[model samples]
Structure formats: C-alpha cells, structure tokens
Target: MITFDQVTVRYEDTAEPVLRGVDLTVEEGELCLVVGHTGVGKSTLLGAVNGLVPHFTGGTLYGRVVVDGRDTADHPPRELADVVGVVGQDPLDGFVTDTVEEELAYSMEQLAVPPATMRKRVEETLDLLGLADLRHRALHELSGGQQQRVAIGSVLTAHPRVLVLDEPTSALDPTAAEEVLAAVTRLVHDLGVTVLLAEHRLERVVQYADRVIHLPGDGRVVSGTPAEVFRSSSIAPPIVELGRAVGWSPLPLSIRDARRAAAPLRAALSAAVPPPVRPVPGGDRPELLTARGVTVAYQGVPAVREVDLTLHGGEVTALMGRNGSGKSSLLWALQGSGPRKAGTVAVSSDGPKSKDPRKLSAAQARQLVGLVPQTPTDLLYLESVAQELDQADTESGVAADGVRARTILDRLAPGIPDTTHPRDLSEGQKLALVLAVQLTAAPRVLLLDEPTRGLDYRAKSELVRIVDGLAAEGRAVVISTHDVEFVARAADRVVVMAEGDVVADGPTTEVIVASPVFAPQTAKILSPLPYLTVAQVAATLPADETDPDS
Candidate 1:
C-alpha cells in the first residue's frame, strides 16, 4: 500500500541527507515495523507516508512516495487524510478536543462524516482500544498512557486504509501497550489495514510485525523478515540477543518461543546461582529524602493519596505501575514543583534537621531535589544545545560557562552537536540534555519520569551507566517508567504503585519477578530462574558453549 521509490530527504543547511536512496514497499494489510537507533530518520520515513516530510516539515524530497494509489507529492496531508492516518510521539500535541469521546470524533467531523456514522465508529474504536471506561474523561486529566490510547483511537476512528504510528506504545504501561498492539494486529489481520509503525521498544512490537525495515544511521535502508534482519542487525530485543548468546537454531522473537527453546539452557543453569541482588541500603546509608502523607488532587479528584516514601543515598529506585496510577503526580510532589494537597517532603542537607522542600525557594528546592520530567523538552527553550547548557550552568550557579552542564551531558550521551537546535535532537538526546541540566544543580536526590520513552537498548545502556555512576557518587535516584526491561537492568529497588497508593516496595528482583505484568522478558522466558536480564542469563552460561552466529 505504501511505496517509496528512491526516496532521499534533506533539509536546508545540512551536510548530509537524513534519508538517502530509501526504496521500500509496504504491502497492503501488512504490519511493517521500522527499526533503528536514535536520530536515524525513522520519523522522517514515517512522515513521508502522510506527506508531512516535504510538505509541512520544509524538507526536500528527491523521489516519490505513493500511498494507496495516491502520490504524497501531488496530494497534501489534507487531501490524503481519507487514506492515511498518522499518530505522533506526543499525543497531547495532536489533541484538539477536551474529552476522549470528543477527540475520537473530531477527525470524522473534519471529514464531514455523518453524525450517526461518526458515533458508531467512535463506539467501535473505544471498545477496540479498551477505552470505553475513559470515554468521558477529559484529555488533560488522563495519564500519558491514556492520552496515547486516545490519540490512536482518534486516528483509528477515521478508518483510513493506511495507518502510520510513531511510538504508539511509548507512553503505555505493559497491559495498555499489549491492548493497543493487539488492536493494531486485529486491524491488519481482520480488517486488512496497512500499518507502518516506528517504535524504539522493539520487545513489545517485534513479535507482531509482519516485516521489518532496518534503518542504519548511515542513511541506508535494509528490509527483510524479522529473523533475516535481526540475524545481523546491531539493534535487537533481549529475546533475540538471548537467542544469539545461547546458539539457538532460530532466534526466538516472542517469550513463548524463547521459553520453549530455553528448556536445556534452563536445565544447565538450574544448579548455577544467578548474580547477587543489589542489597537495599538500610540505616547504614543516610536517608536523603523523606515524604509523609503526600496527597495530590485535581479539581476534587485525588491522583496521589496520603503516600509515605523514603529515599536513601547510593541507591536507584524504579517507580512502576499501570496508567493513571499517580506515578507522575508522586514524582512531581517529591520534586516539590507539582501540587501536594497534604504532604511534607523533607530533604536532608548539610544541617541535621530535615527541611521541607515545598517551603524552600525554587533554587533551594532544585538544589535539594532535581527532576527531569516525562517531557524533557518542556525544560528546554534555548536556540541551541550550547546555549541550553550555558543557561543551565548559570541557573544552577555553576561558575564555568558550559563546564558543569556540558560535562554531565558528555558523560550521559556523547557526540551531540553543539550547534543543533534542541527541538531537532532525537528523543534520547533531548532526554540526556535535560538530565544534564538537572544534574548541574547536584541535588542529593534525582527523579526521572518515563526516561526510557524513546531510548533504544544502546541508549538505555548508557543511561544505566549514568544512573549507576550517580548512585555510586552517593546520590539517590528514582526512575518512574513503564519499561519493565529497563527496570530489570537499572533499578536496585522496585516500588509499585496502584490507584495513587504504594502497594509493593522491595528489592528489584523480589518486586518484579513475582508480578506477571511488570516482569521483564528475560525473567518471563527463564521462569523458575531468578534472572532478570539477558546479561544475567549469559553470565551463567558455560564458557565452552559457542554461538552459531559467531
């Protein structure tokens, strides 16, 4: 349904094209997955399908992009709206209506769809995406994951022949992501809709992909079956990596297949012990921050309710839960920037007495607890990366022009151009920049919400290293995220919240291994084993075993 003939895209004042000589065909009724590293033009490729690349983004297109017999070059996005529906990374950016039901119907209304037909389609989409319960919820009041589902439902209601989604499940929890992906698969299988999706979380969607399109950063496109592409591709999920490590005959894409192939490996590792779990720091380690009776409400509705928590130095905590579970609200409350109807957030500083952060000035609060919110771009408004770093240094009271901020950024993610606009950077790069800005304050406690939203495995590894380094330096870090695999790797402790309350809090392995919803792919596949990551499994493998690929 979608064809790109020698497509090459370049922007003004750029030395190289973002996409070069990209020729690929996405067959009708197929679920095509676009895979690549950060800043690898995955978005540019998706945007081309709906004519958003050269038409709205001001980029030059060298060749033609045809979608459902309509050339995107000739038809603008408005003209192709009937055939192509696009959902972006940020759902709120595309929302025009206040409530979920209204947003889903807005697209059909724009197309002059009949009121009866629109109502029917809206109901169907609500049920398809499991959004019936949230049909009346206001858009702003919903959590990030809920907003994402609404965004997808809005596009799905249009009933376009071709659907293009960019990180559709990035903001969703495990269950929500599964529901959305299941819905998309149904569209491809039951309704014969062509889907072109780009996602950084390969583990969640790779199994559902009919075909894979690999984009190497060098502007070359490689297209093949999942096994063919992952056989040699550097970017892959843990299942694929585990298959490669164990020399499995065929690389398993799903947890079921991996588990079936893991019987012998499981038997071999039965007697071997997994690595020691990181000890949850006790009273020996100083408590850096404490919160009591924390309550956050919006318009008489409570989001976080009377929660008590503690953070200790030299530890990393993973805050996890389902959508609308008050994870973000609790993070904001802890940072002292978000609302707390009734709570006391105390930070232990040089003095023995703990000081309430909400009572402290903005500067004082930042110095005590720094926060990098879910939308890291919200903290950035500068024209260039250099300026953002400089401003962060100035605001954080760092004497050097760009020393502190730039140093932190370099340690987190190296090779980001100083002259590039902050908005133009990849999602992972933007996150690193924001993290650098927050770290320049050198707070004893650090909080990151949904930090792995757009990061690939490589970028996530870099982040894990950065978090480990921070904790080693005697700083407490709390990462609020839905990426279970990330939590398995980076967190020393796991805190699971439900309905604005902390339900489970313990060491990382204890908290996640028992829960089906939050367990990582590795843990799920190697059931009965305590392994949480591919590296952990690979560590216990006999040294004599050889990988077939090698």
Candidate 2:
C-alpha cells in the first residue's frame, strides 16, 4: 500500500535531513506501529506515505515514495485523497467543518463520491467510530477525544485504502484511546484498509499491532513483530517488564497474555517479590496551599461553585475528570489565568505573585505558576533546543544560580539534539522541550496541563521521574492529566474533579485503587496490591528480602 525507497527529506532551512535514506513499505491491510524516541523522525516517516513530507512540508526529497501505485513525489496530498487518509495529533487543527456530520461528509464530497453513497458511508463511519450519538453536535462542543474520533471518521469517509495517523491517541484519555484504537483495528480487519500510525502510548497500542517499526534517534528503522521489537527497545510497556523477568522468548504484547504467562511464575517468584517503597522518612513537610471558597463562571455559567481545595508544598497532586468537568477551569483559577470571585488562593508567604519563581514565589503570577500548556510547543519561540533552555533558565532565575540546561534537556529527552531547531523536531520532542523549559522555573507549585499527552513510553517514564524528583525536592507539583497511569505513578495524591467540584482526593493508592474510573495497568495486574511501579511489584517477591539460607 505504501513504499519509501532510499527516501530522505530535508527542510529548506535545515541542513540535515529529517528522514534519511528510509526504505520502508506497508503492505495492504497491515497495521504498522511506528515507535521511536522523540525527534527520531517518526512523523516524517508517516508524512512520506501521504506526500506531506515534500508537498505541504516543502522538504527536499532524495528518493521515491510510492503510495498504492502512484509515486508520492509526483502526486500531492490532494491527488492521493482517495488513496490515503490522515488523522493528525491535533484534531482541532485538522477540522474543516463546524458539525460532526458535516465534517465527515466534507471529505467524501471533496472526493466526489455519489451523494447517496457518501451519505451511507458517512453514516456507517459515524457508527463504526462511535460518533453516531455525536453526529449532530458542534465540533467545538465535543471533547478532545470526541473531536479526534470525528477526525478519524472524516478521514474514513474518503474510503481510502490506507490510513495514516500521527499520534492519534496522544490527546485522548485511556478509555477514549482504547475506543479509537479498537475502531482502527476493526477497519483493518473488516475493511482491509492498511494503517501506518505513529504513536507515543505504546502500552495501549503495541499489543494490537501486526508489525512494530522502531525508529532510533540516530535514524534507523528496526522492524519486527511487536514483542520482538519492544523486547529489544529502550522503551517498553509493563507487560514487557514481566516478559523480561520470567524469560519469555517472545515477550508478551498485552496484559492478558502476560497474565497467562505469570500464573505459573507467580508461585515461582513469590519469594523474590519485594515490598513497595515507602515515602522518604522524616523531612520538612510543607504546609498546604489552599484555595478557599472559590467560585468561578464562564459565559455566565457557573463552572466552579464555592470550591475549596488545598495543594501541599512538596507533593505532586493530580486533578482529573471527564471533558467539560472543570479540570482546566480549576487549574486556570489556581494559576490566576482565569476569572474567579470570592476566593483566596494563598501561596508561599502570602506575597504578591512573582514575575518569576524557581519555587513558591507569590510576587509574580506568570512566573510563580509555570504552566506547560496543553499545546506544549505553542509556547516555544526559541531558535534551537539549547537556546530554548537558556531562555527558560534566564526567565526563571535558574541561569544565574546555574541549572545546566543540557542536563535537564538530556534527562527529559536525551535523544534530542541541542543544536537542532525546535520546530523541526517531532511533536513529542517539542512537548518534551517545552516541559524542560517549564521545569526551569523550578516553580514550587508547578502546574502542567496534560504533560504526558504526546510522550512515548520512555518519555512518559522520564516525566514520571522528573515529577517525582520535584516533589522529593520539596516543590509542590500539580498536574491536570487524563492519563490514569501517570497519575498513579507520579502523583503522591489525587484530586478528581467533576462538574467543577472536587469528587475525590486522597493518597494516590486510595484514589486510583478505589475509583472504578482510574485503574492503571500495574494496579490492575497487582490489583490486591495497588503497586504503581515495577520496583513496587518486585518488592513483593519474598526472595528479594528473605535470607538465601532460608
């Protein structure tokens, strides 16, 4: 369905090729999962299939890219509309119509499908993608996940034989992501359409892929079965951890398969599993930063009504909820970025918000609450990766005191080149760079909106470590994310919001394990235990703690 032979793509401004000498092919009906560290050219590889690399991107192409039979170099994206359909990471950026049904029908109309057939196709796609209920809804009214589903539906209306997605699930919640992937899997199985998707959340998608393509940061595509590729990669899912431990030849791809392999190993390794890590012993436990009797309204609608909550000084607290449930609103109020009434948000010293704060500066609002926006890269303007970090350090007062920019860069995203332009990197890499900038503030109460949205498994873990480190350093970190796994792993406590009110708040263990909505993979596997990390589960093995003589 697609082919790339010795294809190299170089943008006009950059000397180095984004995609280099890529010889790749996607067979008809095959679901190829593209995995890579950020900035490794995963998106560029997908762009080749749809002619976006040299067309819209205006990059110099070295070799041939053939889609279904047409050479992509000779054919632009518009000409291949009937052959290829693309669903990108940002659904809003790709939307063309105001309503869901119209959006789905727009592409088919452009393809000049017969009206009767287009209507049927659109209806079927709406049902298939689970958008039938939302067909009449406005595009802006839908949640991010719903908007993505609409995007997929719109693309599928073209009846393209091949589907190319660039991180389709990056913005979606776990359940919504599962729905979208399931829909894609059904397309491959039922319609015989081929799929080439670049994804960050491998733990959810790896199990369903027929082939996995690992694109190293240094520019190489290593292809194998899902288990084979992940087993050898630096990044892998939780099931892969179990595979490594028990010596499974072909690593298990999914949790179900891992559980099957673990049944016997459970008894064998019971003595080796250790206990969970307790929080660090005595230290200065900081006071709670409280928002007292907060009330907020948007367009005259009461979004948050007299809500009171407290975020502690040195702990990571997460705010989670469904779409339109006021998670973003609460964060905005906390940051003073949104309008509120009758509330007192007390910070360090009750001082005015600072212009910049490494931690807990009430003097400056903008710098005191360092926020990594949902669209991470939208906030970046620096020319190079190095410059971005330097600017961030300067703004946050860390430059004078000196936090090595490269150290933070390498820690959060090691594979990214400091000399490379930020705009040229993949969306995931850009997000990582923005995160590095936000961390430069070293803000006492850091607020991140969907920090791990587009990050891959490896990048996600890096973020987890970073968040944990911040909390350990006595900084309060508050994140608004849809990833239950992330909340479980990084957050010491959870604050769930619904309809602008706090629904649940407690220790991470209690909130995640107790709620039916937020069961992370590790929690599910070690259900009775509620372990969030591999180390936590490994600690359960008796042999890890018992005497060898015993």
Candidate 3:
C-alpha cells in the first residue's frame, strides 16, 4: 500500500537531507510503526506518504513515494485525500467543525459522497470510535482523548484506503490510550485498512504493531521484525531494556512476555534493597506553595472541587488521573492563571495574600508559579527559537544575554536549530523550547502538564535529569503525566485525582505500587519488590549478574 524508492528529502537552508536513500514497502492491511529520536525525520517520512512533504512543506524530493499505486510526486495532499488519511499529534489544531457529528461528516461532504452514504458512514464512524455519546457535543467540550477519537473518525468517515497517524496516544491516559489502540486494531483486523504511523510511546503501541521501522539519528533506517529492529536500536521501551539487562534471548516486546522470563531476576533482587529516595525536606522546610478550597468551574459545572494541596521546597510530585478528571484545571488554578470559581492559592514568600490569587497581575502570578501547558507551543509566540530564548532571558532579569536560557534548552533537547521557527519544530522540540522559556524565570513552583507527550526514550532520560536537577536545587516540581515509567523514576510523591477530588496521595512507592493501573512495567514484572524503575532494579542486582552476554 505504501512504497518509498530511494527517497531523500532535503529542506531549504539545511546542509543534509532529513531522509537519505530510504527504500521500504508497507503491504496492504499491515501496521508499520516508525520509531526515531526527536527531530530525526519521522515526520518527514510520514508526510511523504501523502505528498505533504515536498508538495505542501517546501522541500526537495529525489525519489518516488507511492501510495495505492499513485506516485505522490505528482499528487498533492488534497488530490490524494481520498486515498490517504493523516491525523497529526495535535487534534485540536486540525478540527474544522464545532460538533463531533458535523466534523465526521465534513470530509465525506468534501469528497462529494451521496448524502445518504455520508450519513451512514458518519454514524458507523461514531460507533466505531466509541464517540456515539459525544456526537452532539461541541468539539471544544470534549477532553483531549475524546477530541483525538473525533479527529480520527472525521478522516475515517471518508473511507480512505490507508490511515496515517502521528503520536495518537501521547496525550491520553492509560485507559484512553488503550481504547484508541483497540479501535485502530479493529480497523486493521476487521476492515483490512493499512496503517503507517509514528509514536514515541512505544510501550503503549509496540505489541500491536506488525512491523517496526527504526530510524537512527543518522540517515539510516532499519526495517524488520520488532525484535530484530530493537536489538540494536538506541530507543526502546522498559520491557525491551529489561530483557537486555537480564540477557533474555528473543527480547520481549510486551509486559506479559517479560514477566514470564523475569522469574530469576525477580528472585535475585527479592532480597536486595533499592537506594532510599531523597527526603522532600519537610521538618524545617517551609511550604513553598499551598491551595485551599480550590474549585474550578466551566459553564457552572465544577471541574475541580474544593481541594487542599501542599508542595514543599524540595520534592517531585506526580499528578496523575484519567483524562478530563480535572488534572489540567487544577494545575492552572494553582498557578493563579486558569478560572477558579472559588479557591485560595498562594506562595508563602509572597507574604500572605489577603486578596484572591486570581486577582494578581500576570507578571506577579508568573513569578510565584510557572506552568508548561499540555500544548507547549501555546507559550511561544516569537518567530524563531533564538528570538524566543532571547526574549525569555531578558524578561527573566537574569542579566544573561540568552546564555543561560540557551544552555537549558541545549541540555533538554540538544542541537535544536536557532533559526528554526517555534512552530516548525517537532512536538518534542517544541516542548523543550517552552520548558526552557519557563525555567528561565525560575518560579518557586514549577508545574509541567504532560511534559513527555512526544519525547523519545533518550529525550525522556534528558528530561528526567532536568527534573531531578531542579528538585535537587530546592525547587518544587509537579508533573502531570500518564507515563507510569517516567513517574516511577522522576516523582518523589504521587497524587491521584478522580472526578475533581484527590483520590490518593502519598509517597511514590506507597501510592503507585499499591494500585494496579498506576504501577509501572518494572513494578509489575518484579511484583512485591517495592521497585518502580528499571534503574532501581538494576541497582539492587550485583553488577556481575546482569550481563547482556550471559
């Protein structure tokens, strides 16, 4: 269904092509997963499938890319719209209609399908994607996961032969990510629809993929079975890394398979103890931030009810919940930015605010707290990455000429081009840019909402270091994420919310390992061990036992 013959794409003002001499074929009804580091041309390759690369994106293409026997070189995205359906990382940015039902039917209308046929397809799509209940609801009213389903259904209604998705599950919680993946599996199994997509969260979708395509940072691509590709691939999920650590032959791609081979390793580490987590400095440590009676409402319906929370000077907190369970709303309210029907949020150093937090000026509130929203690009308005960093350094009053901010950005995601536009960077790179911009201000409390949405394994490691470094410096870090693995490594404490209330809050191990759904893969594999991360498990085992060549 898709073929790339010696394809090479070179964008303007760049010395080297993003893709060099790539040759591959994806058969009909097969799901091909493309994996690569951040900004390493995975998007460039997917864009080439529908002629969005050289045609719409202004790049030079050297070879042919064919979809459904039609050369994309001759066909633009609009011309091939009936054959290829592309869903991007951000669903809200692509929405063209107000209601769910209307958006699903809009594509069919553009294709000039018969009115009866369009209506039938729209209903089927709504049911297929489990969006039947949201048909009449406004698109804006739905949560991030709901909007993703609608976006996919909108393209599916057109009855395209091939489906292309970019990081479909990045913004979703564990349950929501499962639902979306199951829907895609049905399309491939029940309808024989071909799928080509890219995702950074391999742990979420690797088991469902038919084949894996590994894109090394250099201009080389490896295409083969999952095990074959992941053998030497630099980026891999914890399960694969676990298999490597224990020297398991035929490395497992899923948690179930990994658990079966973990008997010895689990037993070996059973008697061992993980290093104690650094204390959050509570005895003499002052309360850096506090919230009481925090309630956020939209259209008279409370999204976050009266909740009290506290953050210490030195600690990492994980705010976790299902989608639309008031995670994002609470973060904004605590930052004194988003709407708060009733609440009191104040920074201790601000000297006891007699007035409401919502009444503070934008500048004053920003100094007390800074938030990196779900869509990091929203905080960036400047034209280029360099301009954004320079402006941030100036506003931060750091007396550095873009030196400090640039240093942070480089550490977060190395080698991001200075002249590149903020909108032009990949989802992961955009996240790094916004994070750097906010950190320059050095707010007392830092809140990151879905920070690892598009980061590869290596990039996430860099983020882990950044988060740890911030906490070590006595800054409060609260991260809202669905990545259990990351939460296991980064957060010192866990706070779970459900239906606008705090359901559970305690130490990381006590809060995360106690629950089944919130536990990380390593925790599941080595059950009853109180271990939450691969690093922790490796640390517990003696160096002589975990040989890769054993």
Candidate 4:
C-alpha cells in the first residue's frame, strides 16, 4: 500500500536530508510503526506518504514515494486525499470547521461526496472512535484528548484507504489512548485499512504493530518485526528494556511475555527492599510557595476548587489526572495567569509575598515561578534559535555575552545549529529550546506542563536527569503529565486530580503502584514489590558471578 524508493527528503536550510535512502514497501492492511529519537525524520517520513513533504513543506524530494501506486511526486496532498489521510502531532492545527460534526463532514464535502453518504460516514466514524458524545461540542472548547479523537474522526470519515498518524495518542490519558489504539487496530483487521504511524510511546502500540521502522536520527530507516527491532534499538519501552537488562531470551515485546520471564526476577526482587518512600513534610524543607483555598472558575464554572498546596525546596512533584481534570488549569492558576475565583497564593521570594500572581509584573512573576507549557513552541517567537537564546538572556537580565542559555539547550539536545530557525527545528528540538528559554529565568519554582509530549526515550531520560539535578539544586519542580513512565522515573511525589479536585497525593510508589491506571510498565510486571522503574529493578538484582567449577 505504501512504498518508498530511494526517497531522500532535504530542506534548503540544513545540509543534511531529513530522510535519506529510505526504501520500503508496506503491504496493505499492515499497521507499520516508525520509531526514533526526537528530530529524526519520523515526521518528515510521515509527510512523504501523502505528498506533504516537498509539496506542502517546500522541501526537495530525491526519489519517488508511491501510495496505492500513485506517485506522491505526481500527486499533491489534496489529490491523494481519498487515498491517504494524515493526522499531525497537534490536532488543533488540522481542524477546518468549528464543531466536531462539521469537521468530520467537511472533508467529505471537499471530496464532493453525496450528502447522505457523508452524513452516514460521519456518524459511523464518530461512533467508531467514541466521539458520539462530543459531536456537537465546538472544536476549540474540547480537551486535548477530545481534540485528538476529533482529528482522527475527521480523517476516518473520508474513508481513505491509508492513514498516516503522528503521535496520535500523545495527548490522551491511558484509557483514551488505549481506546484510540484499539480503534486504529480495528481498522487494519476489520476494514483492511493500511496505517503508517509514528509514536514515542512504544508501550502503548508495540504489541499491536505488524512491523517496526526505526529512524536513528541520522536519515536512516531500519525496518523489521517489533521483536527484531527492539532487541537492540536504543529507543525501546520499559518492557523490552527490562528483558534486555535481565537477559531474557527472545526479548519480550509486550507485558504478557515479560511477566512469564519476570517470575524469577520478581521472586528475587521480593527479597530486596524497595527504596523507601520518604514523606516530605512542610517543615522538613523550605516552603517556596503555599496556596490555600485556591479556586479557578471559567464562566461561573469551577475548574479548580479550594485546593491547598505547598511546594518545597529540593522536590519534584508530578500532577496527574484525566484530560478535563483541571491539570493544565491548576498549573496556569498556580502560575498566576489563569482565572482564580477564590484563594490565597503566596511565594517565598527573598522574604514572603502573599499577593495574587496575576498582580505581579511578568518579570516579577518569572523570578518567583517559571512555566514551560504543553505547547513549548508558544514560548518562542524569535526568528532563529540563537536569537531566542539571546533574547532569553536579555529578558532574564543575564550578561550580554552569557552562554548559560545556550549551554542549557546543548545539554538537552546537542548538535542543533545556532542559525536554525525555531520553527524549522523538529518537535523535540523545539521543546528543548523552549525548556532552555524558560530555565534562563532561574525561578524558585519551575512548572513543566506535559513536558514529555514529544520527547523520545533518550530525551525523556535526559529530562529526568535535568529535573533531578534542578531539585538537587534546591529548586522546587512541578510537572503535569500523563506519561506515567516518565513520572515514575522523574517525580518524587504524585498528585492525582479528578473532576477538578485533588483525589490523591502521596509518594510516587504509594500513589501510582496502588492505582492500576497510573502504574508504569515495570510496576505492572513486578507487582507486590513496590518497584516503579526498570533502573530500580536493575539495582536490586545480584550480578552474575564466575562459577568455581568452570
């Protein structure tokens, strides 16, 4: 259904091609997964499927990309609209209509389908993706998860034979992610729809993929079965990594297979004491911020209500919840930009300041707290990355020749040219740039909202180390995320919210291990051991010794 023949994609700005010598054939009805580090050619490769690479993105294509025997070089994205449907990383950018139902039908209308057929397909697609309840909701008003569902529905309504998705479930909660994946799989099995997908969350879709494609961030594409690729790939899920760490034969690609091999490991870990969860009391550490009876409302509707919270120095706290559970609102309210109906928020800057964050000037607010929002690119507006860093230094009152911001960005993602445009950088690179820009402020309290949205395994690991390093420097960190695996490795405390109220708050293991919904892959396999990460398991295991008989 999809074939790439010596396909090389190059942009004029950079010397290297995003994708080079990518030759492959994806048979019809097969769901192919593309995996790689951030800034690799995964997105570029996805765009080539429907001719969005050189056609829409204004890049140069070296070879032919054929989808359903239609050369992408000859057909633009609009021409292949009936053959291929591409859903981008951000769903909001894909919408053409105001409401969910209208967006679903708009594609069909563009294709000049019969009104009756369009209406029927729209309803069918809505029900297939569990978007029936949101059919009437305005596209702008929906949650991130809902917007993702709507994006998929809008594409599926066109009844295209092939679907190209970029991080389809990155915005969804666990339950929503599973449902969306299940729906995508059903298209392959039941309707024979071909799919080419790219996702960093391997644990969610690795087991369901028929084949895996690895792009190692060097313009190379390696294709094989999931088991074959993950066996030695640097980018792998916790499940596969655990198998590799313990020397399990035929490395388990899924949790079920991992469990069978985990029996012995589980027994061994049961004998070892897991790291004790320490209770961080308000008195134990310096309180950087304190909020009492904080309530945020929108149009007389409460999103966050009477929430009392405290941020302590040398702590990393993770805020987790469903899509509409006020996670973002809580972060915005705490940052002092969002609406606060009622409450008192105080920051310990120099002495103590108990005023609303909204009242503080932008410069003053940064000194107290700094936020890296979900859409990291929103914080960047300069033409080039170098300019962004220079402006960050100036805004933060750093030395004119200061390389502190540049140094931080290099640590997050190396080898990015200073002259590269911020928009031209890959999603992960963009995120790293934004994070570095925010860190230049050196605020007492740092908030990262969905920090792992576009990061790969390695990038996430780097972020974990950075977060740990920051907390060790006596700076308080709060992260709002749905990436449970990341939370397990990076956060010391877990705060779960539901229906705009704080439902659970405790140490990481005590909170996540107890709830099946939020548990990491390793925690699920090594149950009853209170383990949350593969690193923890590796540390507990006894190294092999030489046998005297040998």
User: What tens-digit string does per-residue lDDT give for candidate 2 at 16-64?
Assistant: 7777787887889999999887767788888888888778877688989
For model 4, where is the 10-residue window of minimal lDDT?
A: 541-550
Regarding lDDT, does 1 or 2 come out ahead?
A: 1
> Which residue runs does candidate 3 get wrong by more than 4 Å?
276-283, 350-356, 400-403, 548-550
Using TM-score as the measure, name the better of candidate 3 and candidate 4: 3
Residues 371-445 of candidate 3 have per-residue lDDT tens digits of 999988889899999999988988888774534788888887888889999998988899989988998988778
Where is model 3 poorest over a 10-residue stretch in terms of lDDT?
276-285
- For residues 212-276, write the lDDT of model 1, one tens digit per residue: 99998888899999989998897999888888888886789999988999998888988988975
Candidate 1 clash figure, as a count: 0
Best by lDDT: 1
Q: Candidate 1: where is the Cα deviation over 4 Å? A: 277-283, 398-403, 410-414, 546-550
Give the local distance difference test score of model 3: 0.86
Q: What TM-score does prediction 1 earn?
A: 0.96
After best superposition, candidate 1 residue 474: deviation in angstroms? 0.9
All-Cα superposition RMSD per candidate: 1.8, 4.1, 1.9, 2.7
The clash number for model 4 is 0
In order, candidate lDDTs are 0.89, 0.76, 0.86, 0.86
